[model samples]
Structures are given as structure tokens and as C-alpha cells.
Target: MERPFSVFHYGGTTSYDAHGGRRSRDIPAGEAGSGLGGGGLHRLHHHTDHDGRPAPHREAHSESGHGWERLVFSNALQAVSIVSVVQCGVGLSNADVVPKYGFGPIIKFLKVLVVQQILWAVSLSLCKIAILLLYSKIFATRAMVMAARIMAGFTAVWTVITVLIAFFICRPLSDNWLLDLKNRNCGNQPAADGTMGVLNMITDIAVLVMPISYLWKLRLETYKKVALIVTFSLGVL
Candidate 1:
């Protein structure tokens, strides 16, 4: 008597038979191939119950409970950053006053500039923190969550240090924007500025690259991986 047989059709054309209670054997292409016109085995294996499809580990929480915090923080950062930029532009526009009023007016402008810098640092730090929180919300991997926490800590520390550097760059604190430049002693402003710029870029790059490794490790096609990389790359710009 013939062994019990079953015909399983998948991927458009290919069918499989179970013989002697063993694993199903895929019919070779061109033999019973009449389905999707491709390798029946390929589609069967990849699309078995949509196994190959990317599944979200968690629901995206961008505007729900904790997600609402991310939105608020991001909006506040944008507002503060815009104000700082406008303040800087106004300060620079006073170029004529600098020559006409001597160091006094320029010193006053520097005071305002210093305040703007503080605002910028605060906004930037908050922006990074918000991004990390969003990452933690979307990706459920322990590595991703831990990385976000670490980066948030780094951002907080950087904010504190940069603000302190800005405030104490000039001695007596009041001498920062005062006209008593001849007798006042100020720290290396240029060096501090350069250092902060480098640190800012470094942190930004760190945030941009943080999720790349996790994304690359995912079981996704190369095109999908590249798309994800591009999405994160927007943060840099």
C-alpha cells in the first residue's frame, strides 16, 4: 500500500508531500512549479506565516503617555534654539556699534552672546536626551535601552560643564561683559569655544551612530538597513 500523502501548496506553485510521517519535501522547480513563478521553497521558507517580515518589538510610543514627554521636550528645544539663533544674529548685526562705541558696546554684546551660548547648550542637551528616550521607547533591546541611558548621562554632564565654562570664562563673573577689559583677566575664550565645538560634534555623532549597530544586526534586507541608516542620519543635519 502507498504511504499516506498530503499536498501542501505554497508560494504560488510549489507543493510538498509528507511521506512516512517525515518532513515535507518541496517539489523541484519546473516540476510542480505553477505558483508565484519563483522557487516555491524560497517563498515558503521566507514567507511562512510572514516570518521574514519585520515585526515591531513594541508599539511606537511617540505621542502617548511617556511619548508625550518626548514631544514636549523636542518642541521646547526647538523654541529655545531658535531664540538663541535670533539673539546671535542681532548681536552680530551691531558691527557698526562696535567701532563707534569702542570695547564697551562689544563687551555688552559678548555678555548677550554668552547667555545665548548657554541657551544653545541647554537646548542641544535636551534634544539629545529626547532622542535617546525615543529610542528606548521604540526598541526593546536591552543594549539599545542601556545605550540611551548612557548617552543621556553624557549629555547631562556635557551641559553642566559647558555652562560652567561659559559662566566662569571671565574672572569676577561680572567682568565678563564689563568695560574694564584693561584690568580684567579672562580665561582662554577661544580655546574654550573650540573645545566645546569639538565636544558638541562628537556627541552629535555619537547619537547618530548609536543605533546603527543594533539596526545592522537585525534580520533585514540590505535595502531596509540602508533606509534605516538614512533615517537616523537626518539627526546629523
Candidate 2:
């Protein structure tokens, strides 16, 4: 009698007997292996069916197994990050535009500035929500899940309010870019911006602290727990 084991390859799985003879039907390729041509050990395991036949299993790669929420949030983060970079490039170009183009470009710059502010709020909120979702997924405790949900909701609401404030800070909307427009009534723009900035920082601090309590209660050693907490806290910086 020969012992049987399964070999997982990039394209598919193959099982072999003790004599190196192929024993089972080739398993359809799974998403488990790196696509590199030269195969290395991905995983090795052996199992026998109740009647003494080799049992082959399909293994799912981490990327393929990620939940939809992870995909959605991560893609959204990437999209917003790309847009933010483009906005920064536009901003840099404005320096040259002002020297050559004068006030004509200033309005455009101010408009871009407003959009950039909203983008900042959206990007930050998405990041925080993604982190909170990860916390819920990883910790899975009732308290952690509830806290994550509450914080996520609050971050989303804050983003919505911030965008609204940025968009509507000036009556007639054009007042944001038309600095010299007559009879344009706008809120204290600088003060509103400052308040929003402070609130953003406060949320950052709250997110940083939310996981510390749960981490401290983990069965990890004190030094390990402290290290983990420090790692998570780096997001604030």
C-alpha cells in the first residue's frame, strides 16, 4: 500500500502515490499560487478519504478570498488617492499659471481648492472607515464591532457635512472663487476651515484610541501588546 499526497501547482493540483505515480484526477487550477513559472512550495499536505483514497482540496488565495467590503473600500481609497494626486499636480501648476495667466487662473485655482478640500475629507473618511472595518473583522468582539460600526458611521457623516460646508460655504457658490464679487455673503471661511481641521484631528485621535483597550486585553505579552498598540497608533502620525 502506498501513501498518497497532493501537490499544489500554479495551474492545478496533482496527487502522487509513494512510487511517484500520479493517482488522482488533476484538479482544476485554483488561485492559490503565484504566477511565476518556476514553482516553489506553496503548501504541502496529505489526507485520505474514509475509504482510503487520497483527498484533494482546493485552496483559495488571500486575494481571491477577501470580502467584498475590503475590495470596495480599498478600491475607493485608491481611486480617491489618484484623484488627490492629480489635484496636487494641478495646484503645483497654478504657481506658474498665476505668474503668467494672472487673476483669470486664480478663480480656477480657488475652485480646485474647494474640490481638493472635499476630496481630502472623503479620502480621510474612507481610510478611517476601512481601518474600522478591519478592526471589526480582526477583533470580532461585540464591543469592538459596535465601536467600529459607530465610528464608521460618524466618520461618514462627518465627511458628508464637511463636503457640504466646503461646497456651500459661500452663498451663490461662485463667491468661493470670486474673491472680489460684490455683495457676496459668505460665512467666516477661515474659521470654518479651522474648525473642520480640529474636528478631523479629534476623529484621528479617537480612532487611534479605540483599539488600544481591546489590544491590551489580548492574551499577548505586555511588550507585544504595547508594540501592537504603537504600530496601530502610527496611523495618527
Candidate 3:
């Protein structure tokens, strides 16, 4: 009897044989069944048996240890992003709250705004770190893994610095929300924001380009490489 095979539709279509061996159309024949392609999510695609039912195999255990790590980071990013959006909707809009009310509402808005800034920095950092972790898992090259670790560390340090700046930008921290308070010494708000914004863009671009080199080296067709690159580049948007 002929062995069973299963076809799965991930970013690209890939077929698996009876022994849980992957054979992607885009990947060369020699490279097929070497290891799983794509990220951790690809591991979810299982091979089928002669009856077309899902069958478990050793490939399912490939990089299984990092599953929880990815889940935790992804979940944390979603939770933080959701809370940031909710907080912004409730009390952080300067245009909506400032014109309709007096200093009382303005102060409240500023307070929420401060918290929102910290959350924004945190959420952004979490997103970058999550991407780096995914890179480390999927690429798994020594250089790629080292770069991912360095970038993750940099992202964490950047988040801490951003939060610290948000908290201590104004001395006697109350002055952050206390608009009319006397003897307030605040740093250059616009300049600081501009600098951070530029730095954030730099980091974003760095992360976006990190995988391109490794991806191009893969034994894939040009169109497939472009498609893969475009898919990864969507993070910029």
C-alpha cells in the first residue's frame, strides 16, 4: 500500500509524508524533511495517517520547550496593548477632556497620560522582544541567536529608560500633572520626545531587517523569498 501524505496551508503550502517529514514546494528537494520550516506555529500542523486522520510524530517535539515562552510573551503583549487602549479611551484624551472641563479634569487627564506613556513604552518593547524571541527560535543560527539576544536586551533597557524618563521628566513628580505649580523644573519635553521617537524608529528598522539576510540565504525560489520577506516586513505596519 502507498504511504499517506498530508498537505497543510500555512503562509505557504507544505506537504508532509507518513513519517511526519515536511516537503515544501518552495524548498528544494534536498532540504525537504531536514527540519520544520516557519515559526513555532508551524509545528501545530501534523501529518495524517492512511485514514486521513491527524497523526502525531517526533517533529511535534521540535523546539517544544520554547512554546510556553512564546505564548507568555505574546499574551503579555496583547494584554498590555488592550489595557493601554482602554486607558486611553477612558481618561487619556487631552483634546476631549481638556476643553470640556477645568484644571481638575486636565490634571486627571495628565495623570492618566503619564501612565499611558509608560504603558506605551512597555507595550512597544514587549512587541519587539517577542519578535526577537520568535527570530531566535525560527532562525536558530549562532549569529542570529546572538543578535536576537542582544536586541532583546537593548529593548528591555530602552523600555526601562523610557519609563524612567516619563516618571522623572519633571522634578517633584507632582509637577508633571500640576500645571500651575510654582518652581517646577522640567526637562526639554519636545526634544526628549523627538529623540526617543527617532531612536524607536531606529530600533524598529533594525528588527525589521534582522531576518532578511538569513532568509535570502535559504534555498527558496525568488518569488517565495520575496513573499516571505514581505510577510515578515508586515511588522513595520
Candidate 4:
């Protein structure tokens, strides 16, 4: 059966044909790739069932591991959507949509927005870390578990560094000896970022290859091993 999809964006609307390919455009109207209708919501149309249903698809079996993996992936996708939407909303809104007559008004609004942005990034990064941990579990080995721990540790360190960057590591704080926590930068950032980048690349290389290597020596299908490696790489990606 053909899948049902109607992506409404730019100046055009597209729907799937019975063969799951493009049907003719019902409307062609704004800027290309705007991902939005010009100054308004775009319209969409789809083929429907007699019961007036729309965009139905196959159901997952309850016992399927694939279904669970999809759930994890989708949860990660949800974080992506939430961050985009919230940031977009803030960008589209005025500093004070209902204006007040003071510097305090704009500053307060900006402070709230900045805090929200940090929260969004932290949540998304943590979700990504968790998804990688799940990937390690699915293809578990002694080395894979170690990789997971190392990745998790990096996540924690990065998160702390992010907090320090956001608050304590400002230029003003840098010169204040009493408040300063470290002489070196708290981030994994090196004096030469390339040094740190190489270290990260090496770690990612080991994490990506080690599990797949272990899986390969087992008698799993070639396709399965390749798929696992590909999906695991996406976590680091």
C-alpha cells in the first residue's frame, strides 16, 4: 500500500500517489525551501479512507526489538523538534510583545530566553547520550560497555564545562582569582583545538569500530552487522 504524506511548505504542496511517488501539486504558491508558507500557514491535502481517516500506516508488533529502537530514535527526534520550535518561537516574538517602558523589561525577557535555550540544548545532548548508550546495549560486548562508559563520562564532563562556560568562565570571571576554579579551561577544548579534536576522533573511531568488530566475529548476517555499525555511527554523528 502507498504511504500517505502531505508536506506543506514553501510555495508548493505535494502528496503521494498510489504508487508512493509524487502526485501532481495541488498548489504552487512562496519562496522555495522556506519550509513555511509566505507569511502564513501552508495548506496540505491527502487521500483519505471512507471513514475520513488520514495518513495511516502499519503498526508495530509489541515484541519487536526494532519497535523499541524506533521508540528511542523517535524520542531523540522529539527533542530536536522541541528545541527548534521553542527557539523559533522566541526568535519570532518581540522582546516584549506587550511592551513596557523600561530597560528591565527587555533584559528580563532576554534572561528568560537564554535560560530556556541552555535547558533545551542540555536536554537534547542528554537524550543523544542516552540513545548512544542504548545502542551499546543492543550490541553489547566488554569493549562496547567500556565505550559506553567513556561516552557517558564525556557527556558529564562536557555538561559541566558547558555550565562553566555559560556562567563561571566569563572574561570577568577569568581575571577574578577568588572565583576562578581552574587555571586551564574546563572544556575538553585544547590550547590547539585540533589536539582535542584528534583525541575525540580517536575515541569515536574506537567506539564505532570495536562493537561492530565484536559483532562480526559472531555468525550474524553481513547486513545486520553493517546496519549496526551504520546506526551506531549516527549516534556520534
Top candidate (TM-score) = 3
lDDT by residue for model 4 (103-214), tens = 4334444444334434544554465566556645443335566777777677556545554544543344333222234653444333424543464465456555654554
Q: What is the C-alpha RMSD of each candidate to the true structure, in Å?
A: 11.5, 11.4, 8.0, 18.2
What's model 2's TM-score?
Answer: 0.59
Poorest stretch of ten by lDDT in candidate 3: 32-41
- Candidate 2 achieves a global lDDT of 0.66
TM-score of each: 0.59, 0.59, 0.63, 0.38
* Candidate lDDT values, in order: 0.61, 0.66, 0.68, 0.49
How many angstroms is residue 49 displaced in model 1 relative to the true structure, after the best TM-score fit? 32
Residue 48, candidate 4: Cα error in Å is 51
Worst 10 residues of 2 by lDDT: 32-41
Ten-residue segment with the worst summed lDDT in candidate 1?
A: 40-49
Residues 1-237 of candidate 3 have per-residue lDDT tens digits of: 548554432223456666556666654422432335533123234555776545667446664664464456556656655654554345356677556654565555567667667767876787788789888766655788899999889888888988998988998788888777566688887888888888888889999999887667555677877887898999644
* Evaluation by TM-score, superior candidate among 1 and 3: 3
